[model samples]
Target: ESLNKLMKNLYSTHPHFVRCIIPNEFKQPGEVDAHLVLHQLQCNGVLEGIRICRKGFPNRLVHSEFKQ
Candidate 1:
């Protein structure tokens, strides 16, 4: 119940999501799994409601506000 309420609050901000992809699990550095990569983006807001500025900047975060 608390989690749901928190998610709803976060969602109300209309956040743009950035999906970090794990390309492969074979311990290969350059190997890319296109299906998995594409799947994450497809399911997320990548093609849907990601807001971009007119100059193509996504969003701004102050130095102290950035999370790891």
Candidate 2:
């Protein structure tokens, strides 16, 4: 019953996902590896997705809509 309800709710709305990628395996603060981050982004298709979104709708918001 709970699963059915959850599925129904999810289907009713448009959902956007946020992917969090770790910068380093060491988990140290103030440490970031550019190559690792780039590799993760490529593997996750995030870069390509952003490129497609930009190509489709570069300016989605109007000035008035943005203000609110």
Candidate 3:
């Protein structure tokens, strides 16, 4: 099922590439589904399953009170 796995991977990374099916009308979790994309090569084929990856936070912030 390479095609199925491939399709699954594409929808996981780049979510914007795919359109949402349920339109978020009910705003329910997992109620609807859509295609997602995976830009990073590291994430390839991981869409069929779960894999742990490094996490990072946004270092830049806007309109911060601490800003002078």
Instruction: Compare the candidates by TM-score and give the number of the best one.
Output: 2
Instruction: Report the lDDT tens digits of candidate 1 across residue range 1-68.
Output: 99999979976885545667678767589898888777776777564434445347556677786663
Ranking by lDDT: 2, 1, 3
Which wins on lDDT, candidate 1 or candidate 3? 1
Q: Rank the candidates by TM-score, best first.
A: 2, 1, 3
Clashes by residue pair, model 1: none
Over the stretch 2-65, how does candidate 3's per-residue lDDT look in tens digits? 9999979975863323332343456677653333224322245443333333233212335663
Cα lDDT of all candidates, in order? 0.69, 0.82, 0.44
- Candidate 3, residue 63: the lDDT equals 65
| C-alpha RMSD for every candidate | 7.1, 7.3, 14.1
TM-score of each: 0.39, 0.60, 0.21
* Candidate 3 residue spans exceeding 4 A from truth: 15-68
Against the correct fold, how does model 3 do in TM-score?
Answer: 0.21
Which candidate ranks first by lDDT, i.e. highest?
2
* Residue 26 error, candidate 2, Å: 0.8
lDDT of 3 at 2: 100
Give lDDT: candidate 2, residue 58: 45
Candidate 2 vs candidate 3: the TM-score winner is: 2
Please write out the lDDT profile of model 2 over residues 42-68, one tens digit for every residue: 999999987988888443557896666
**Who is ahead in TM-score, 1 or 3?**
1
